[model samples]
Target chain A: MVFTTIVNCVRARGPDEFWRKRRIFKLAAHYIGRRRNCYTVAIKIVHRALVYATKGRQLRKQDITELRNARIIAGCEQHGLNFNDLREGLLRCNIMLNRKTLADLAAWEPYSFKALTDIAKQKTKEDGFGSVKDLQAPVGVITRGMSK
Target chain B: MSVLKRVQQWATFARIWHVYDATWQNPFQSAELLKKYLMGIHKPIYHPMNDCGDHVIVINSLDIALPGNEWAKRVYFHHTGYPGGATWTLAWELHRKDPTMILKKAVYNSMDGNLQRRYTMERLHIFPDGNVPPELMGNVSNQIRQIRPMPKRLDHYTKEEVEKFPKIIDYPKDYILR
Candidate 1:
């Protein structure tokens, strides 16, 4: 690698440039047109794509949380109980189930979810929580603090 | 697919008919609940591109309650794509003209205005009263609970139950009749 001037020799990055540009090219391999072939274009597009990929990871988590909340709300409404009351009642009962597990129970194990709603209803009745003022305590399920 | 797998697929995708009694229910709130069923969003297998929505049969739409002065204030607008062809109708007026119109409009408006909206709406069946046709009623296997409990009228309470309710305060001896 002969250089006509010292300035050109200093500017040339040598083998290190090949490996650096190759990394960006590898990342942009799936891209189309000149963006995939040219190092200059590939680096810019890859950087933008990486930004989107980073943001997408956060968005994916948010989307799953939203879906789980919707499923839980749907499950709550099915049993004539609102979401707040279910969560509050379960919390009061010391039964701490996360949204994902609760959603899974609601969708796949419906009978178990129904039992949870019953227990929740019973707890709400004992606590005299919202909307359960007129709701009768669920039969055959005596919750704690009921004998008081 | 094998017979067992085919049967499993059918069971997973089969559409269910849900019944909702709109008696004394707020139309707007009921619409939000019914929309979930109509779009099958409540199901675990729900997807925007999937055709898994269920049929919702709303009964006694004539008895829907509008909160506060909504019946007099809420207006329905219509235009006929001609000069001076706009008109507004109040909620009660529209309801009187068509008992099922308010609920139908509520459920329709609650959904997203996408290309699938029209087809999704076709799955909703609204009856002005409880006298649904036998064919439609036969398909209903689940009943969606009301958002609010029906207010019990004084006449609705049995004589013994009303009498059994404890009185809070007796009228003063010198209390004047209004």
Candidate 2:
């Protein structure tokens, strides 16, 4: 009951209250405002703090995947394959890939990803899926620490 | 092995193996061991004020084993509180997407970051794949030791503690597990 009341009170606060950079800016404020002696309040408050500290942990992979997508999108564009054509054509084509694995190989071994892309391009042309792009990537196109 | 000798062995092993095979994935599963291993508590070097500890590196993080239905019911949540204050994800989803991470996270969290925290951290090695840290493996030269099984552990709370989960309750019956 106190938690709900506290939450309600915090929610009642006007727009100006700087909610602690989170959605329920009020929950913390209400409990904090009153030096609640209740042991339950103290425990609940600490639990929420732990959740905040560890929150960044879960997002690490999503960020890495986003980086991979950027690299592939750039690679596709350079080869004259638009993102739309690449996305659609790659789907129907027999390419079995995921952004992470593809990006890893593309980064560590561009030639390999290029070779795969070349086959993909050929399939696209054969099936009349999209424009044929050059697979003759520049030599030494690889980057440091990219050898997957 | 004598309890004293066994304690010393565990400390050395904890420092050497960052990702222990038996209970590394869910550090919480063997939290008592991890804590003892990292704290140098098992050894006579046990000084509450002093920080004597070892580092560990874990390999085969993705292949880590789990023992119960916890992966389904457990939910990890975080919130930035801009518009949608809370974001929630399931433990199984987390494991399938990146199995190694959750264990790494769980181990790190259960660990106490005291004065010796960094030193203890130095011993921990967590790999997403089963790749061992070659440099650290060199330190584990003594094959005389076997891979010690982590003793099973679980968190126990007095029924009195569970009562306080809710901030306020008028009736004692409210806490009874429904």
Candidate 3:
């Protein structure tokens, strides 16, 4: 019943298949000799690398938090207000500005940040917070009135 | 809110710095506060699975208060997983050995028992005193109000300030000097 020509199983699959795997193998090119060349070793190395990549994403998130914390702290120190006082003051004024935005404003837009700080200082004063009492009021051009 | 506005909000992940003065603060209360910050429960975007917790920097941990003789009554136990390996340490003794251990342990115990707890604990920075490392100093953005007022130190009052302080009692000249 089987009267067909002989088929070759050991032949190359195709350029598409070859390149598809080669792409990942290329990623492992910098790997040690056999890990880069041998397809079997290359796949294993690639899999491990991918796992590291996934973990790297989580590490990146933590790094961002640390960076943001640093920026906010620097901003608070420059403005002579503790981070908590600034946040509380802002919260009382119904301004829910986040630390990232505040830090950005502190770095790039000094005038805008100053206005926010003044608002916070005023709110802290009204709330009877002892910490902000000693902070000097922003100099020049009052933006918001001193009222609750 | 519009979808675009919501997306914009989500895009800006702002991490907050929460400061706590552990001076005379009950460990349980401080632990609760730390948990709130560590779990991001205080924020509107809090989710159990998401890592949205804020950073907490605790100062004066050495001065943390233990209510009603807990310093002597409370005990921390540990074991080495072997025969006769069990060890018990009193709260005061532990504090004396490591000033930050009590608060750290309280907060650690309060956190959820899961893989994410270690990651959350990394955000918590504890200092024995008000002096923080210069590297971490920039991260402080806000302070949580102290639960109890810190007792005044004698050196804090100047000679003139002390003279102006109100006298609670006027002792008679005949009273024997201590």
What would the TM-scores of all predictions be?
0.64, 0.35, 0.51
Models, CA RMSD each: 7.2, 31.2, 13.4
Expressed as tens digits, the lDDT of each residue in A6-100 for candidate 2 is 55676535565343234343334556633233445644775687587677566766666656665676566546565555665556564667777
Each candidate's number of clashing pairs is 0, 16, 5
DockQ values, each candidate? 0.25, 0.01, 0.02
Q: Which candidate should be chosen as best, given DockQ against the real structure? A: 1
For candidate 3, write residues A74-141 as lDDT tens digits: 45655677778888888877898887787677655666877887788777765678498765655552
Give the fraction of true interface contacts kept by model 3: 0.00
Tens digits of per-residue lDDT, candidate 1, B1-178, equal 9999899789879999999999999999999999999998887556578798999999999999999999999999999989999999999999999999999999999998999999999999999998999999999899998999988899999999998999998789999989
Please say which candidate is ahead in lDDT: 1 or 2: 1
Best by TM-score: 1
Better of 1 and 3 by lDDT: 1
Local distance difference test values of all predictions, in order: 0.89, 0.56, 0.79
Badly placed stretches (over 4 Å) of model 2 are A1-148, B1-19, B22-26, B112-119, B141-178
Higher-scoring candidate on DockQ, 1 or 2: 1
Full candidate order by lDDT, most accurate first: 1, 3, 2
